[model samples]
Target: MTGPTELPVPDTVDVRSGPEVSDQLLSLLPLLGEWHGEGVMTGTAAGSAQDVRFGQWMRFSHDGRGFLAYESRTWRLTDEGRIVGPDVRETGFWRPRGDDDVELLTASPEGLVEIYVGRARTTTSWELTSDVVARTPDAADVTRAVRLYGLVEGALMYAIDRAGADDPLRPTMSARLERLR
Candidate 1:
């Protein structure tokens, strides 16, 4: 999207603090930082119950633009208690359509792409529902997803629900992350 005609758009904007952000995005300021945490994932893989403990690192930042840049990496814990993998990595952008409406476009190396429509419930909370779910021919059979994010006790907390091919929607993951910066 182009900048408002009245304000001249710069050729480049410093991601940190170089330019002013539109007011529409201000409601999401609480998410503009790095966060790290641990969580447990429970589900069935191919009809077998699978549970895993994972560590996550997520960052949401801006380039003085209207949208926030996003990136997340997760590692699985081994039974013996060792951290391994970046089993999953996702990159995306969160664009505020208005004070109470937002959009998220995300892509994962695992061959999944998603667009989520979110509604702000409060200045620091949002409920997101997938508008589209596209996957590469070889990607996992994820068919639908929903997410919730909020600031609870000064920490970022989130939960995700997912449904795959022939699978019912179920809670997939949830985590509480401390802001690192």
Candidate 2:
């Protein structure tokens, strides 16, 4: 005898037809989808010495649970709009506490793991400050970070500010992505 191959409780991008989303996650309802867009990346992070254009795809999905699984992948784009190669990739989860607080846990390919806690500023906006920025022995000297995500008009907009060993917090990346479906 064999069991089903499909996930017992699969994550769903289509909220209307997915396992009834828990009311606990309703505060984050607007962010349920896959988004793709281009954004500018600039900083002192090695390859980011100059302003670089990057394309990003982010998904926020739930599996009939209280948290939403998240993933983001970005690729570098030449000024001429050519895809050079991959840039940064990360995956994590978003959990809402009660009615207003939120927690985001993410792990990056660069050996960094972040735990951010914040709250819903409005029905369409959230601001998070890192409670911890842990990294492996070879990771960048990231000390702390903050991120803000919002829905403007019909687009998903986000920005991240980070501080390293001797670096002050500054804008690292910001983007506006459109829902694919």
Candidate 3:
């Protein structure tokens, strides 16, 4: 059997910072596209003997709505840049509140959900802090997290700082991704 030909209101995948998107989403429009790149992770953070690398694909889409849909998937890479295995996957939404306030809701298949709130620091930069982090019984221990995303030199670059119950917040992972669209 075949499924339907299309969604009733299919998501639009290639909207730039224009009037098509909600006014609240203007500050986030630059991120609306597919991004791919590789980055290094601390040994301790990667649960490995030493620092490791990973490749990631991230996307931001919209349906001419008030929020943006977000998703990210990553895979582990070898020293020679070959895929080893899966690393992380996340799905979420970005809700721009009022004019400048932003709220990000994200979840991982590993059973962790995080709610973040912040504001656009610049036309191309955003800083978010974790307001809540909930996990299942088997999930990893996460106490706090912060993220900074910036459009730097024509690339989408981001860094995450995280901490556990017993650990202090520190830089964890960062990547410079180029838009594929």
Best of the candidates, TM-score:
2
Candidate 2 local lDDT, 90-123, one digit each (tens)? 9999999978999999999899999999999999
Which segments of candidate 2 are over 4 A away from where they belong?
1-6
lDDT of 1 by residue, 72-173 (tens): 988887767699776668999988886689898899998999999988889889999999999999887899999999999999999888898799988888
Give the Å shift of residue 179 in candidate 2.
0.6
Top candidate when judged by lDDT against the true structure: 2
lDDT of 2: 0.91
Q: Which ten residues in a row have the lowest lDDT in candidate 1?
A: 6-15
Q: Give the least accurate 10-residue stretch of model 2, judged by summed lDDT.
A: 40-49
Model 3 agreement with the true structure over 1-181: per-residue lDDT tens digits: 9888887676866764433777777888888889999888878778888888999999998888889999999999999999999998899999998777889999999999999999999889999999999999988788899999999999999998889899999888888899887
Give one clash count per candidate, in the order shown. Answer: 0, 0, 0
Clashing pairs in 1: none
- TM-score comparison, 1 vs 2, better candidate: 2
TM-score of each: 0.85, 0.94, 0.94
**All models, RMSD in angstroms:** 6.3, 2.1, 2.0
Off by over 4 Å in 3: 16-19
Question: By TM-score, is 2 or 3 better?
Answer: 2
